[model samples]
Target: MNLMTLYDDVINEDCSMIVPETLNTPHLVLRYFRPEDAERVAELAGDIHIASGVLNIPHPYTIDDARDWIGQHRFLRDHGEEIIYAITVRESAILAGAISLRVNTEHAHAEMGYWIGRPYQGYGYATEAAGSMLELGFRGLSLHRIYARHLSWNTTSSGVLTRIGMVHEGVMRGHASKWGVFHDVHWYSIMDDEYYSSSVHADHPGRDPSGV
Candidate 1:
């Protein structure tokens, strides 16, 4: 079977709880968010530090809002073409953040985005989670290019992209607006060739390491 078919088999579980969690390295994990996650999600959603970088998440996010958000994720999880994964720590059931992938069939590529809670910042959760998502994009999804971007002023997100080894593709001036405030975004991408070459080198030491 193709990788997409296997990936489908993996997430098609009826209970969702039955889906085996993907262990991304050791510090962070990527998994489907459960409805029970609403309360915990509210804590992050309410923080301006966490929500500001995002275009839609408003400060003082309501519990009722979180309930609706969870319901939305559940619907997307079951029927949508895109995949969204929540980043959570293993020891604690608390959610640190979330990352998502949107495929562009026309371009034969996908784009990724993410956010982390304020308290969880600087611990490298975004970096770790992004690496896992990159692996999924290049390997599981078998896509040609995976891109990610963030507002130019959002240093935390820029750092996360750099940490994950994505090559910056420059900025989009006045790309979007939030709360009537215009924001520019920096774009970054990794191609299938880039990912494959890096993986081959990392897997084989004492080699040229440059895909020479």
Candidate 2:
């Protein structure tokens, strides 16, 4: 059997836990959000550099806004709609970013999304965390496909998507409005078989170190 079928067997046997407790890469840990994380979330996500690139964040992202956002994660997870993680360093345990997968169970796919704090942007944390998230979606949740999108001008995000083995699909012109400006969105995706066949996945040294 190929890697994809092998993963299906492994997940069916020992991976009985529904939602993973934590997901780990060589350098990062993707854990469930905590109430105490609001301060750091606000501090990192509130930056103009981060907020401006994504369509959802608003200017002056307040602590209340972070709390409210974090608050919804559990509800969403409990309902099997999404899984949101706080991305942190494995050694330092410092918050580096956030990553999430919005599941569409009926369609057997999930939409991946992520952002790194300005301080952590250059360290490859986004790519590392996102790769682990993809593993979680495919192997852990048995998702058939995982996809992500970025603003056309956000080449950094595009690079992260590519680094994680997603295939660039196409662009949606004027697909979203961010900070009162409309922007084209470039989409990317990877199917389970495609991921298993990828060089990145074939030699993925990180391998969700926590095995979640």
Q: Candidate 1's residue-wise lDDT over 1-212, tens digit each?
A: 12342255533324121123454546666787778778888988788876778876887898878788767765554543467788876556568888887765446477887888776766767777778777776666566898988888888777777666678999889998877888898899888888777742221111111211
Candidate 1 off by > 4 Å: 1-21, 199-212
Candidate 2, number of clashes? 0
Lowest summed lDDT over 10 consecutive residues: which window, candidate 2? 1-10
Runs of candidate 2 exceeding 4 Å displacement: 1-17, 202-212
Report how far residue 154 has shifted in candidate 2, in Å: 0.4
lDDT of 2 by residue, 146-172 (tens): 999999999999988888899899999
* CA lDDT, every model vs. true structure: 0.69, 0.80
Please report, as a residue range, the 10-residue window in candidate 1 with the lowest summed lDDT. Answer: 203-212
lDDT of 2: 0.80
How well does each candidate superpose onto the true structure, as a TM-score? 0.81, 0.87
